[model samples]
Target: MGQQAMDTFRSCIPLFQALSDTARQDIILLLAEHDRLTVNEITEFATLSRPAISHHLKILLENRLVEVEQKGLQRYYSLSLDPAVAQLKALIHTVETTCCKESF
Candidate 1:
């Protein structure tokens, strides 16, 4: 890859850069409850304003951390099943498993 493309790819680390801890935890929790959610549902569930949810969704979407689907007039968001998202989850799993080994 070209330097610019490499830089852009590195800049888009959804597992790290796309969200703060609070927002990331919130998104994870919401996904656990429902496989998919509309922006309005997220806003209501998170107790965040609509605009705030929109902004977070934009970042998550750009990073491929979330996927979107259209349902008539509504748009729903869900965890992406793409490679990057999978890798991110795998990384987290590795860390958790390592920690468990150390504790036991």
Candidate 2:
């Protein structure tokens, strides 16, 4: 792998870590279905506690998997997956082009 591909793969580490948890996956699905939701709203549909939801949200936010919108006193979280998806696609392309080439 070239340096650029290696760097792209490294940059995706946090995104992978954030998505490895079932709690976080549930939150992502909820947001996808609802468009946006507050921590309390997410906790209502999930078995996790409010603090646990917040903790997962923090990780998601840090990884850019989700975005937060401030409305009045309420904060609504929603999916923000374009950038992460692009990075993953790039990594896949790099691997396909560099490592999957067939010899004649």
Q: Which portions of model 1 show Cα errors greater than 4 Å?
A: 1-15, 86-104
Cα error, residue 1 of model 2, in Å, equals 2.3
Compared with the true structure, what per-residue lDDT tens digits does model 1 show for residues 25-98? 58757866798999888888887789888888887787777788999999999987475656665555555554
- Which lDDT tens digits does candidate 2 get at residues 1-104? 78887887888899899999999999998899988999999999999999989999999999899999999999999999998899899888877777677732
Give residue 60's lDDT in candidate 2 (0 to 100): 94
Distance (Å) between predicted and true CA of 3, model 2? 1.4
Cα displacement (angstroms), candidate 2, residue 83, comes to 0.8
lDDT of each: 0.71, 0.91
TM-score of each: 0.64, 0.93
Candidate closest to the true structure, highest lDDT: 2
Task: List runs of model 2 lying over 4 Å from the truth.
Answer: none
Q: What would the C-alpha RMSD of candidate 1 be, to one decimal place?
A: 6.9
User: Alpha-carbon error at 94 in model 1, in Å?
Assistant: 14
